[model samples]
Target chain A: MKKFLSALGGVILLASSSYAVNKENTGCGLGYMIFKEQEGLVYELLAVTTNGTFGNQTFGITFGTLECKKPEKIANRKLEIFVAENMDELAQDIARGNGIYLETLADLMNIPEEERPQFFSKLQKNFDKIFSSENVTSADIIDAIVSL
Target chain B: MVLLHFKDGKSLIDDPSFFLSPEGKKNPYKELQATIRAINRNPYLRCKFPARAFFIEKFLKINLPKVKCPELDKFLEEIKGEKISLIFADYYINSPASMFGHTFLRIYDREKNVYSFIVNYAAQVNDTNALIYAFKGLFGFYKGYYYISPYYQKIKEYVGIEGRDLWEYELKVDREMLLLLKLHLWELKDKYSHYYFFHKNCSSEILYLLGILKPNNSPHVRTPWVIPIDTIRAVLDKNLVRKINYYPSLLTQLRYLSKHLKDDDVEKVINWAFDKSELPKNGSAFLYEFAAQYVKFLYYSKDIDRRKYIKKYLYALKLRSKGGKINYSIKPEGYPHVSHRSQRFSITYGFNKVTQYMDVSYRPAYHDLLDPPQGYKKNGEIVFSEISLRFLPKLHRFTIQDWKILRIISLEPMYSFYRPISWKVDFGFHEFLNDRGEKRKFLSITSGFGFSIGEKITSFSLGEIKVMHNFDGEMPIAVGLRIGLLKQGKIFSFISSISSGKYLKEFNEKYFFDYSLRFAFHINRSLSVRFKTNYQLVGNKASFEPSVSALIYF
Candidate 1:
């Protein structure tokens, strides 16, 4: 319950602040806070994350938008962006219990091409839970994938 | 003269520090020969001999035999690094020598991995006493040298032990520039230079090193003092820095973890470490992970011994494996580059008990209690040349109020894991009321040691002692004991101290109390206002003075 409240608070804080500039920032957020961690806000995030490489280099190694982010995590990030960008198409696709975008995401997640039918059926059933509204964000998508 | 010219507009090397046979200014070739001869006589100078040799050949028209170090050559081959970067270790106020912070250079291998080698120029002193080191540093009594060590060694020292962050900037230099840099570094191999705390220190020396490659591009600070941040900015202004990275200190990382961790969960980990008999169950993965990292940090910082902590470290790891995978990555807040500059100038008009006066003040050096907190270490300040001038309108009296030579304050906060003592030292000249009720100049030294709670918005209680002396012995030395409270907030920082002491030689008891409040609300990044009021109790008489001032920064 405490975790739930903190997550709700974080959602409100992020929504209110300039941190809303980037939707890709996930992972820690309120989840880590409830888990005994403080996630840096987006504005404060860059300040704390990377150091004086000044402008040219980044920490560890760069993997697109995330540093040292693994391939599977990248797929999850892509899954979130794809769904948010095409919520209406995804809604229609899930209503029929199948879609091309879902198929592409599944491929990225390394789901077998043959299992697309059953996968879409399960996703379609969980669509409302996955994204309840226009306010539903990428973090919710990542949570759905890890839990699903 | 030629050697001096090559050294730059004005050489940082003081004459007494030089050991060459023929002085540098008299004859350039002879200076090169002496340097080469010294290099031949000593193996200690081997690492730096090559660059000096190349420099002499290029500028002085002297073709000296190339210095060789097969050992270093093979080591360089092993590293295979093509790029170099400048590193700045944040100020460690506990040690006065590092109050302005420290800067060094690093060589990155072709892999460009974080792990690299560090080249540092610092005074060679084995003194463990902070006071002695500070005294020597103030006088330029110690010799400075360049030494290379592994990057992790620096991290272990600065980050873990001293609790300071390290920021690194990669310079955009071509292969030719890189070669010139290497050659120039060798010139100073066995040479010693006077290390001035404000002017010729580590950061300034780094500027000289860069000047060797791109002399025109190095934006030299006109001031006598060169702070590390100024050097970083100078490099940026010259377009010398290509990239930047920040390596957070151990304390920062721990705080990052602690902010997210629950109080009980963190307590369990601490209890488990202290009470070795039993390991706590029902621990989450995040707690275990934090425990492991925290333990490792403790071990590296030498707060714990590996022999004793090994079992605990391994236990935390095992617990973490069971806690399952979790992402604990944290993003930081805003860039430090947005903070205000160091120098501050203020002008104010006010009415004292006697008359109305306008006061102007300038602080040339650094952080003071009333200064903004951004881009500066919390509770750390070094102030120099804090001069105040006052002009009375009714009496037509224009006099110097006070001139503070130097003041150093370290307010290291006490945390759950660490307890650092807070202390301060102040020395300067000020005008005080004499027995005749006239303003007189006197030299005073004030030193205090006490405990402080909170920072930025903190309330601190401290005991202090001060001594005042008049040169001609008209008034005997006065000593006093006092206590004070300081509560600093975003717009207002107030301090009040009351004390009672006697002039033993003068045969009198003098008491003092004053309250200072500064309001900084009407301000942006570059400007602010200080509305100050002071209530002072001298013997049986009390006086109240209020002042309003506008402060501007460039």
Candidate 2:
């Protein structure tokens, strides 16, 4: 029993190290999440007019910050950002059963090209299941896709 | 010297304090010596100005010094820039400042393509008042600074929100060149120059950054104004670009995806977006998809409220998910590099019923409605500082025909799914025939708002108000209606308009009718032949004029 427990702890250690690697490599990790949520009307307007941010505060994707702890969660975090950022187009692409955003999403999920058609069809057929409610967030849709 | 951006024997750096020596701003030799001495005294200056340090070591063939800059090292390591691309965001016509488009740099890491960062040099603008913004931008009132942000942020702002397409030109740059670029970007951090809208703008600054790598091949702004696309042409002319990629906007993608949908299907999609009807059960994925895109466009254009937009969009998506995948692709045309030159010069010889004349005209900037439509917004016109002179050969005298300071026309065609207002404004001085049928020069300001319909051949009707002041001390205000048909094509294009107005002149109301027709045959990208005619009936007098002209765009 002790040997089995030791083996389990070693597996956990290996998993955690992999998670740390994922955190470091995903260069634009948590900064996007933080910056996007706090973006106000004036900042957006400034971004539109000047193609530059207002004031001096740097926002969006800084050097190094790892808020995500687990490898799976880090992947989910990225998928969530992509979905949320491209929510409207992704929905249309899914409904139409094809689009660049859909292709990109398939790429993000590591869905091979041979499997993408089936996957897109599956999503289209189960659209109601994925987008179960009007208030469905990117996280919820991602969860639906995973479950499917 | 290239890194310092010395032009005409003077440094481009507007700030005096950036120079280490007293005369460093004006004298490159003094600046180079001072930079060397400063690096010798304090090795950290090499880190502060690594680009300059690289240049100094390379040119003088001597190693001055070395210093451990943990911060600089950390920055370089974190960026891991392996490649550089010049990104051009297509023009956003709604904003006066961005009408010419925008350009920036994308520094790409070897493996982290998604995490690539963009370096943008733009005027740090805080004022929302457009007139004030224009005044400041034109006269170098705003200070331009460089800011680095994630690539996705810009993609979201330009492509998703503003519906502006992006063209990526992967530059032929190596690792060493990338290092020089990063170092120069570091040097420019928190530094600023007085931003001039015309010459010392974003495109020019980006070109200066590129000049560090290929100093001799780098293009310079010879014209008084630096157009964004012209900068792209300059770079392309030197064969600096290796590959080109297009990222279409959401609207563009939608247009391409729905191109094959039937008329009834389009109507249904529109109906679904307005919540007037439910989507068909087990509808084709394309239908549902198009419906969702339509709703999203409405939301993005602010035609629909947020609450309605969200509800309708999600519903359509949910319905669309019940169908099979449909295949479609978006291939956009008319890239900026292929567009005709912005400045134009033309000389024409023509004859009316009265006499023959030679006309010489020059436009300093931008497209007119009759200009070649390639790489420009269709049915849209922005002409600035255009002047024409007429020489009557029989009379042997030159006269100012017209001097148009600014004229803007946006004729967006209306559809059942989309309805945008068409508007135009003209501020200019033109020679007009008075009631006595004699030429009288007048300064006129005319503005109109209306609706347009159709594609390829568009028809529009506008309610216009014209205020004119002639040299004879007569100021007349006219309320009129103008209708026109415009056909814009690659090889052939034409526009014919007729206007009728009631003018309040000398405490009396008089009706005036004016008609104009113009046809242009494009010989090539740069040359075109045009036939133009005008007829005017004021009070009981009428005059007609016809002319033929050849235009060369450069």
Candidate 3:
């Protein structure tokens, strides 16, 4: 019961923690706002950067002022960019139902070991359609597993 | 035992001071022996500090007691997974605390899959603003503690949000060492350490906790400043990291994906993510994935409330779910580890106005526009404490040419999507040839705002305003305009600019026109050769110099 509770807490933490910290000047926050041509976003980034600009006191830490960086704001479920990019690798890992690459994918897919073999076996069955066709995505694979 | 904290150990406690404080005469080792006795008396304490208990047992030649909680046992059992990894989250420029990057440990459980737990040591701060947190961090005003968190939560923070690449270096420690390291961590779990940004930082604490694997003598932490990358280098020197892997941040992935898509496709992806009513297009995995990531970025970074954006977020998720997985990964040209240390020193030999001279320049820290861009932004540069001294053979004297106290420039090239103004601000002193052709040193303050566009062979144009306070002239302020092209090629790079400026005040209405063509070659990562030709016209009397120089970086 404690294990189950801890597991559930992980989910809640992942979701809530994503929106919790308000860090200024995610290099991409400014760049993305500018790139998206959103003036409102630019003002917000400026306001945040201005408010938090004076805190750095070390010579080593001060180096970050030169370049832009990404901000800390993400949803609970992360995208499987690696798996999505390497479908063949994903297929091979899934066929085996266990490996380094598959470990991360199964985690993102929220599939436990007991259910992984069967669910990933179905994924193994659709390997060609998934890899050869440009239309199919990791999300589609997730969709198939959802149906299963 | 005398309780001498190794203040010599750069704030890392290793001696009796680890056990006894300044009031050691009466209460020496009181807390330390109490913890030991508590573990023997209470079974729960044994479970909490199992490795520490083992250490105590071996040290005293007595078997330590054991008590186990099913919950704690379950956690240990789960952690006996495939690997132990040290995750390095590279610097995020916007966050003051993580400007030097951050390091944490992860226990991967293969059986439980992604349910791995992340162990982190950081200054516990109540301040939400990064600046205030940094202020607190720099002054050793915060209490540092180790806490257990979900691995995915860290992944979301580092990989999803910050767009900083994640480097996971797996440590191949034996089960015993791993247990001891973890047990040591548990023993120190909530204990407060005076967290200093320089010496007593995250990296040093982690290394100190894993003391068995690390060398007994400390690395350069003997000095007041300790950088994170330097610690990683020390770890490498000691051969601690067994295997390393890279994980691209979501922003990096997005940038890579956007590069592959057509302009129309990228526009469609952005629009599709923003518009909830819009139906999915032809279900290409790449487009759907791009759209999905765009919406995620918006949901995280935008001001829209969670409830309001959840619909768009789920819509994009559903759109992405409609497609099958496509295979590809973003390959950034460089990673954090490959970059040079922030401090730089250089020696150069060149000729100025028919005078042969050798110059030595030292920049106490950081990247500059002209520096090699392998591991830095191509157009962004900032430098401080840069002092250059020139020794002229003709004059048989060493003269200080320029000592830039601080300088920052952002060369934002206009793009179709973004049009940010390029700007520069420099506070420094330089030796300039006056109207009489006399070399006079002046304090120069120059700043400018301009529009710069293009890359590789860049078209850089700027109109700068200069204040020469110590100039031997009537008017010290000069306004100038310069337009030029900067070409950066593999074998060679050069910048050619033409500028004309007039003194604003009563000084002999002197107008100076100048043009310079400079070129450089990359001999290697740490060395370069440069040649320059200058044409200067000061009220019709013109002079030019052709000079060559070789620079060596250490």
Candidate 4:
């Protein structure tokens, strides 16, 4: 009975996991989140050209996460992606106690306009708590915000 | 038939096997008939040319037999494209390929807006050497291919890493147009074309893609070269764009963020960025944020590796998360299409020491330092194939004063947290006085590297090297320094420069000096008046020349 219940619990956990965090390197923190996997020489060369060349054949498959059917799942996934993509800019905006990226984050979180000031201040005050450690992932930061 | 790639009454497709008729490559009517026959006979050809099939079916009022194209269906299903947008990436001055700018299309997915797909056409270039790349790109030696990549990938590449602003012009595309676009893109998959840098480039290819939507009212480039911004203008002219959005680059954001910082705070941020000092304990959120952005800039410029970048970057973010949020917004700059035309023509009437002459000059492309700075890079000048011819009625002679094949100058001013080098290069035939004090023409190449400071009215000093041929039938080399001041204003502009070189000719070394001043008064975007004076001294002999000119840009 214990083994069956534990397996059921594992299934539930897997089902509840957002598609955004399902990537291979999701837990790898800001470094992996922002900088894509080193695509080696071809990527480097394509980047150098400024005008991108044909390097990746599989183009539209990776966007499945953005198409989550559940509203809450979509919100959570969008928040995570935005935070991961704009972490550097968001960090500065959060530290300074204000910025466009921060405003965008507040909007993504559905924080009311009147409450945004308090929310921004709260995030600013809990900066250390949210970031927590050097290797903190976007999921971790989101978890920290949720707890707050 | 309309979907055929036709140029000057001939098909642009190089492969003759693509056509079923013997003369289908040259004859569009034959190709059309062959296409109809092939599609009727074979279901696979309908799948191969879905767009052409759609057009033929709609025009002929006949239903073609359906065939399963799982790959094409899968692509269309995955993209779920509901809208199309023209994305123009602003010029990145550091790269020659992108100096004019770049354009591509973005397919906005209906369900997943953020994860859209971008259709890009670019030359397949493997050469790292700039000269070879230029040669191949200019002569259509490289094969160009269309690429479909995630929109975020391009955003990261252009906005995050390359520090180029993106202007998105969401086009007015409907369901039919979107389907047509996708079918056309499906047809182009794995196809190749000869890439021409100046004409059949990224922008022109995008224009062709857009042409599928409105065949009768397609945007066209009348210019000799297909500039990316010109394509944007053409689209705008057609009233195809519905909305516009601006995404500023990382560098632009950093600059806007640091606008309110004091000198000491900026220094502290710079210090923190370089790891020379620790983050201040009592620093404002702005200070911490500025430091983080500066570090990011460093990372993007490849000054710091990924490991170090993450560490420094995260630490700053952690500190920043402690502060209260401040409200800020970045205002968009002038649109690039509002800038004056690239090609310029001027006529000058002036007198020198010996004779009076009327000089006519023409510049084939690009902005000069004294040109209006409305939509161009400030203090930057790029001139190509600028030739000046002087006519002297008294001497009954017409002489080629100078022919500047290419000239580029980037006078990026120094800043506290961001420092960029100022540089210039010129190659062409120049008129100069030989040792005998006789007028002579020399093939010259000159390069300079140095620093510039200030804005509005800026000053620069550069270490210069000049190599000239046919100087007394011998190649002479000179090494020296040049200093200049430039002032760019809306209605008036001024520039002055002084150069001193130590010339090494055969067994003799001589000192030479040149001084020049120019002033321009702008009447409008297309018209300007200019006055210039030049003084040269060689071995105690001096010559003075002055001129007044009227300029028109088209």
Candidate 5:
């Protein structure tokens, strides 16, 4: 009985060692988000890079370390655009919007609660430049929110 | 037991002080001072006293012995300017081992104030022990003189010193000590004079130590036994004259100076010694030995410039005998920008609309079965315009190395259709009939390339331009290219192309360009799913067709 237990322990040790070796090697994490509003599916844009952005008027998001399965209320995931008249202008707008969105994310994540009011006010001014349309999809909103 | 030959036809132990120290308390320093004082105090001691005393003592001791002496004054005059040769009285010429063991000797020439120690044969003794004894003697004889050796510690040990002052040490020797040291010299002479040249099988350290303990006083002045002039002549001949190259070493010089040397052929041995060039970390020990021997050889060769030889030898010693170690080589360079030599395989389909259609040309009242079959119906008038479909599978195997240099060649086999798949009577059959009712099998041979469309996630490729000659009635020429996009797991790839060519016999030429988009999801190494879509433009027509393919990567 002791011999059997010894053999079983040896096997378990070998298996655990192999598992630890495998756990050390993991590639970059990529997540997909589906953006569906009242209308049909628009264009799906992948959020390859991200941070956070300000919203129009008094509304804005506070997206913390965003994940797809349990997305934060602030901003996360890819954005879809429905009423873009041209693809070239839309690509340019999204690229510019993502930059500010990521900055806002870094500010909110790092700033103290007392400084949040000032941070949000500054964020609002930045968002006014890119928020040309009101009918923005969730993917678009997430892009704009995290990009700043 | 002293038999002295007086200068004036008499025998005497003329210089008694030369036999023993004047202050004979078994101490060398006191005796040295007393002997010097005796010489300084007596003004006549240099010439008259020694000559007169030697004649009187010889007359008394030998009782008018029959042995005749040359006139002492004339003998003295003749030998005055000459170097005094040392004799080894202790050595037995017949006994090889004894001659070798006690080979050290003292030699001195007073007139020239030149002092040197000479050893004839020193090819035997304990290696390490002999060196220590040599250092001890050197320290004893040359009082307060600096002596250095790479093997100084070993010498000290041989001399039985636990620890010694390295920076400063005392060396003081008197007459008796010098006399005792001269015994080794006499042995060297006895050993060399009889042609019983020293054997060389002894350890190298012993020979080196022998050289070190060489005495630097002349025996002719201090002792009765002076080296015979015959022996001197022999030494000069054996050691100084060289057949080709002169090796500077007292021991080698002595060996070469031997009149009846047992072995005269030393070329091979010398060459062997020259070849041992391994740079052992402690290689200085060997170099020091070589330097010591070479210096002595230079000393004996009166004409040879000693300093120049020493400088050259030292330089040679510093050079490494052979390359020490090896290093890794550099990597190869200059690769090509495009790898046109990779083996590839692709299958593509082309679809397009044409001007000739049955709906536009057909208006038949009653069709006769016997009439030549015009496949399309347009107002019942027989009408035919150019329309073609091509399906090509091209495989290219190529190789490339440098960017500007390429040797790429490929083979592509293709199958073409002039009509749509719906119009074919037997789309899947061993043999099919064409518009002329001739049996046709669908396949052609061609060559092309595949290019990537976009990002790694998805790819589209168009193969290179290809020319095909149909094997039917007119041997119609068909040109084709393939396009494909493949994504296997995380990898995405694409290929697309277009080609046009004509057969020599047929005036009508067929052109085909197929663009395919393939997204292959590679599950693992061996399996992948390929989603493919192809758009073909033939002449002025275009069509969009999609296909699915599974790929296996080995």
Candidate 6:
């Protein structure tokens, strides 16, 4: 009898643990937080579900906008990165971003007179990654700094 | 003597005179006849004709031959008396022979006891141009008078004539003519050439004469060359390339090059002039002004695109004074410092009246951090210490093209690497748990940054992690993120980063990871509530135990 009770307790603990994880609700909800980074604005989805919800959502929140007031973090992060490296590189990165954009615009202009629309569409597909939620990288946003 | 006719209509005695036989050969008849002939030949010598005869009769005692005689003595004496009377007819005309000329003669007039003499430009006769030549020589002598005034004056007085009188009367007339000549020469010199003295090539004495300007130290009279803008440019362009000492005046010429030449050319000249060892040393002000002016010109010309560089340059020049005042008059209100690190905290909300229901959100959390890696401890006395930074306005999304450009620029990581990147840094006593599972109060500093990657994602970074040690121990390295919680339509976000300091002789050490979550409501901007829970990780730690706080945003 003792052994059976111990086994039952063990199963209950295991079930509860799993249930607790599921109840935590890892899926992001309808809200988003916006905050300023080095380059510009960035958003992140916030999870509103509490411990009682299931954790069916796998991917992190897909925020529509990132507007948050957390300056301490931004400043601290700047100090860290800048402390270990050369600040000039950061400036160069901004300049390079602007240069590339201009070059892409130039390329789009080079299309033959009749085939311009197609060229523009291709250009948009190739170069518009910085604005979309699906394809932008950290590098794209960091160097977006057009001016100090 | 040759027979000569006179204007007097008195036939000059060509035949021997038979009159005055009381005195044998006493008449000086032959000599008197010859004198009359000489006077007839030269009119200027006519005044001396009688005097010549008297001197011959009185001194040489030579009588004229009977063939040329004609009561010569008495006739010559009478002519002499008439000449003397005419000469003194002005005012006795008494000038010492020694002072005037030695060419004087005496005539015996037993009844009058007088001597008569004819004065000519005797000493002055040596010069062919007479008065003019004599005056010019005197003027030249006066040129030396300025140098030896007293000596020249003594010489003049010793000669019994006032210098001014001599200059005014005897010399002035001719000197005026010479003055006109000199004026003509001066105008010609100015209009045509600097080579006025070129023909003579200036004698050593002439140079010495001009050297009188030496004591006065007027370079205008001395130096062979005067530096000008074009000359400076030529010299600098040819050789001067670095830190040459230069006079303030000469350096003034450098600006023309700077103004007219290309930027690179100006830089080259400046660099060159700076290099020569023989350059003058008073150019600091010149160089400073030159650089300032040139840079300002470049700024206006758009050669340099950033106004910040101009501002920085001006600041370095100390032309501007800096204040902590910032442009916070816009929608957002915050003061930013030129800091390597700072901790900032703010809450802002804006809602659209056009929308039916207000959508509100609140981000409230306490953070603190350190910079320059000073230490892992936020000494309790100071609550917290941190270095922070913040961008203006806010972070936002970018298009795909922008993203690719950023990628090419390779700087998105810099922006994306901030955690909770917004506007806040905090230093204060924070709630934490000690290693023994007991509630403990410790001083802590926290900072973070957020970087946008596309429209939805961001790379987050946390800045400083320092925990004050009440006991003997070092802080631990703790960093992580927690985002899986929600309550009442609000989401909670949290990130914790900590550093474990290396152990030193009297301190035990541990790693730390701190975390916090904000239960922010998505209500309209007018009102939002944020409930937050804070926790710190102490090596292999688990989630935070329940302890929460609330913040209201207006």
Ten-residue segment with the worst summed lDDT in candidate 4 chain B? Answer: B108-117
True contacts kept of each: 0.00, 0.29, 0.04, 0.29, 0.00, 0.00
User: Which segments of candidate 2 are over 4 A away from where they belong?
Assistant: A1-72, A75-148, B68-70, B77-81, B109-115, B322-324, B351-355, B506-508
Put down candidate 6 lDDT per residue, A36-143, tens digits, no spaces: 111111100111111212222310222111121212222332222121121121121121222222232323223354554443333323322322232222223323
Candidate 5 is graded, for docking, as: incorrect
Write down the lDDT of every candidate, Cα atoms only.
0.58, 0.73, 0.57, 0.73, 0.26, 0.24
Error of 6 at B416 (Å): 11
Docking class of 2: incorrect
Looking at candidate 5 chain B, the ten consecutive residues that score lowest on lDDT are: B417-426
Q: Write the per-residue lDDT of candidate 4 for residues B132-181, one digit (tens) a residue.
A: 67789999998877777656667767887777888888888768867887
2 or 6, which is superior by lDDT? 2
- For candidate 1, lDDT tens digit of each residue in B420-535? 66777677788665433345687666666666766445555455555566666544445565555555445555555555565544424554445555555436656777777766
Candidate 4 to native Cα RMSD, angstroms: 12.1
4 or 5, which is superior by lDDT?
4
lDDT of 5 by residue, B1-554 (tens): 11121233322222233333543333444543443344456533323223222333333342221223333243232222212232212211112222111212223333112112222332222222322333342233211111111111111121111111111011123433333223322212212111112112121212222222223421121112212222222223334211111111223222322312223122222222344332233323233233323332332232234344333233322221111212222121111111111111222232223211111111111111111112111111111111122322232322110011111111111111001010000011122123332334422223234333222232333333222223343333333334333222224333332333332223334344445454554454334445556565444455655655443321
Cand. 5 TM to true fold: 0.17
Question: What's the DockQ for every one of the candidates?
Answer: 0.01, 0.12, 0.05, 0.13, 0.00, 0.00
lDDT of 6 by residue, B120-145 (tens): 11121123232333344334311110
Docking class of 6: incorrect
| C-alpha lDDT of residue B304 in model 2 | 72
lDDT, candidate 5, A3-107, per-residue tens: 323433332232121101112111111111111110111100101111112221111111111211222344322221111111111222232222222333333
- Write model 2 residue lDDT over B55-90, tens digit each, in one string: 778767868888887666756764566778888998
Q: How far in Å is the alpha carbon of B51 misplaced in model 2?
A: 1.9
lDDT of 3 by residue, B173-266 (tens): 6676666565555445445677887678888776555455342433333334656666565556566678777777777667677767778777
Candidates by TM-score, descending order: 2, 4, 1, 3, 6, 5
